[model samples]
Target chain A: MMNKKTAPVGVFDSGVGGLTVAREISRQLPDENIVYFGDTARVPYGSKSQNTIIRFSEQIIRFLKTKEVKAIVIACNTASALALDAVKDEFDIPILGVVIPGARAAVEATKNRKVGVVGTEATVQSGMYTKVIQGMNPEITVIEKACPLFVPLVEEGFKEHQVTEEVIEYYLESMRSTDIDAMILGCTHYPLLRSKIRAYMGDKIQIVNPAYETAMDLKCLLEENDMANDGTEGQHSNYSFYVSDAAEKFRKFANTVMPFDVPITNVVNIEGY
Target chain B: MMNKKTAPVGVFDSGVGGLTVAREISRQLPDENIVYFGDTARVPYGSKSQNTIIRFSEQIIRFLKTKEVKAIVIACNTASALALDAVKDEFDIPILGVVIPGARAAVEATKNRKVGVVGTEATVQSGMYTKVIQGMNPEITVIEKACPLFVPLVEEGFKEHQVTEEVIEYYLESMRSTDIDAMILGCTHYPLLRSKIRAYMGDKIQIVNPAYETAMDLKCLLEENDMANDGTEGQHSNYSFYVSDAAEKFRKFANTVMPFDVPITNVVNIEGY
Candidate 1:
């Protein structure tokens, strides 16, 4: 049996977007080995229904458990919003999602008592951030808008393109009129477009990235549970990547953005899980 | 077994984009019943690999066959380009893809011998259109560009929006510089942006929508194979709709654009196949 303290942390997303969260975890928990899965085959869960999202999430969790992970993180915003609650208790290990941590960070950053959220259609429709933020404090007013094209724009490598700036203007023009002091980059893919988003929204509006906060939450969780990996094993950590489809694409994209080099990527038929 | 002359035709796409093709079929063959399947759960097959696309196409074809249809039409251009050849021989029924018909039409429409093709990344990368067109006429020059954002724009109901026009400009600017007299709207969703595409490309450049040509080809296939549905049953043709997920959204989108009302839609777990 694998030691509970040294067992790898499993992280998953619908596609390569979740690498942002994985990178954060790697930065914060340098000694911990990581097993990351990207469901590139049935990706863009943002447009899918709640039932379907839940089903996909459950399948991924089941797959992750087989990796002997001590804990799991739902990195995709859509899956975190729609699937976390339903499957969190089904497994024995600790399960974390990106929504609450981001929501908490947004609540703390907002000086004007108003917070803005930009996410996928499913995440916005779920109103998970608003619910979580308001549940923490009822006084904060949450403004939510679904930027459906942001993910595609980011995935297509149009993060800083003029066309992407036009699209940002198209989606965020109305939101800019409000007095929100902080905006949460609710979708994992949003961080890739952070520069474009920041330029359009201006510096006054604090941009909160959940990946950072989620990593903090994860650190606290490990400390509280005594599941943190000690450095006695080794200084170098093992990071394995498994995607449902397009391993080469995932590797290429990861190498471009990730802090470390992803030398080998395995393709798993996630549907069977 | 169902009567060959009275059985419906199977039309399948990656998602609701194929409704354009289904609507065209309804107009061209008013008497034939149609069974349409939109893999809404695992859609936008454009970014996926050839093996994954082929696997998905096989699954959809198996599901459509269960509906007792006389023939099947691969309405999505990406799947047509990547999957059609692999799966065509496996099934006994006549299977038609949009690429050949569209290539033929583009070959005939381009008087200057310079033809433009716009599609998803996979379709353009496959170089299927260039190969088919050049094979048909050795002298024709094919210009292929992938407009990855068009589908998301159409799906987001931004068909006539200014942002879509900007994106259209972003993708088509280089193509416009060339002397191509005709452009193929290589993806099914592109037809929904016909007005904007036509406006930007100007009046002289002919826009060829493969949906219409594919429908005409379906008509010819039915007639050639003696599979045409006789009108003795009734004028009202039964059109059944199935999707992998989001049945309500499919019905709503279909009702808005389809020639006939889609009163009932069934959700099938296509992954089970």
Candidate 2:
């Protein structure tokens, strides 16, 4: 039997958008197995209410626990912002979310006190990032904007298209006006458009991706807690992907956004959990 | 108790975008009452599997029947394309979907027998428009392109912005190459960007707004079935809106898309049904 330390880590998101986070985690921790669940049935958590987001997160965590995961990562930014607080204590294992790590990294990177955030409307509206940044340093200023079109643009395979560039310029023009030195890519989908966003915002502005920071935090937590999969052999990792609806569509999208070819995805009835 | 004919019509979509269809319905049937449901929690039905959509539509219809609605209008194009057939026969009320009416209108209006369609990926993927048009006239040519960005662009309030114009041009440039005479606004949300879409496609190409055609069909159905509220007393019509997620966000969006001020919206737990 495999040791408990060799058990797979769990990652959950509202949809395929969070594969970016899962990708970053896999890149940093190649020895650890991963089981990813995407709630494609109730996606775009950014627009949903805090209560609904929390309830959905609880159900997903319950389902993930059944998979024998060692740790859980709230890969969906909205879930990280709104649901992580209520459910963190429900499980004995370490739980990490994208929001706190991202806020921390942004504070460390900003030369100037002013920082900018661009995410889905619900993430920005929750004021979670702003509160975290302000909690770390009382005087640090935060400007948050909801760039709703970024997710759809990424999903539409328009990451570097001219239309995408135009849309980026349109959403980020106001962020440029604040003279902020760093901008947090608050939504995971925004990282796919990093090149266009970087080009439009110029070199002076640092783009803080939460996926990278979240992965770093997970690495540190695993090492500190002695949960690292150090005894695992040289075999390549197998990533199990699951979605609540449309496995074929999820597989097709996973192919586009993932670093490697997406293997077969299983469609789970998450609502039944 | 309200008379059967005086009861409100129930219109439903995955989100507030369906208010465009509701607005059109109210325009054509000024005397009729309306009860609209926006399933903001599980929006963008375009990406979900057929089973999930059918299940969702059934839940919404069950809720609408409880509201004493005389008929049900699948104001969402995705729902119309995917779920209407599964539930239409199950209900005793006059059930109408936007797809068949839009397809019929496009077939009737096309002079060159070549028609184009622009909608969300799911609608285009369903090929409902192509099947209906070709079924009506086998000689006619049908071309469908999924303009995924249009809905988000409208939601971002970029309807008249230059960026929107650029995005529109980007998506429709391929359609421009074809000798199509008319284009179907396959998604209900597309009507909000009607002016920009029309300007880009030019007057020689007719842009068929399914919302308008859907309203016309509803008007004809009401009159033919003697369900019209003709003998009702002189009182302002009431519009009741419901959402499965954030009511405030739905209200804000409803104000932008609908011509009149939005009424109070009740946030329902749609999963309960």
Candidate 2 displacement at residue B98 in angstroms: 0.9
Query: Could you tell me the TM-score of chain B in model 2?
Result: 0.94
lDDT of 2 by residue, A95-189 (tens): 99999999999999899888999998889999999999999997899999998888888877787778778778777898887889988999888
Across A170-241, the per-residue lDDT of candidate 1 in tens digits comes to: 899999999999999999999888888899999999999999999988889988999898868766788999
Model 1: CA > 4 A from native:
none
Model 2 accuracy (lDDT, Cα): 0.88
Taking chain A by itself, what TM-score does each prediction score? 0.98, 0.95
List the RMSD of every prediction in angstroms: 1.3, 2.5
Best by lDDT: 1
- Cα lDDT tens digits, model 2, B1-273, are 657788899999999878889988888888888999999889878777788999899999999999999889999999999888899888888899999989989998999999999988888989999998899999899999988888877777787888788888888999988999999999988887888888888889888888888999998898888888873588788889999988998998899777789978899888877
Compared with the true structure, what per-residue lDDT tens digits does model 1 show for residues B1-273? 789988889999999989899999999899999999999999989999999999999999999989889999999999999999999878898999999999999999999999999999999999999999999999999999999999998988788778888888989999999999999999999988999999999998999999989999999999999989879877678899999999998899999889667878999989888
**For residue B233, what is the lDDT in candidate 1?**
70
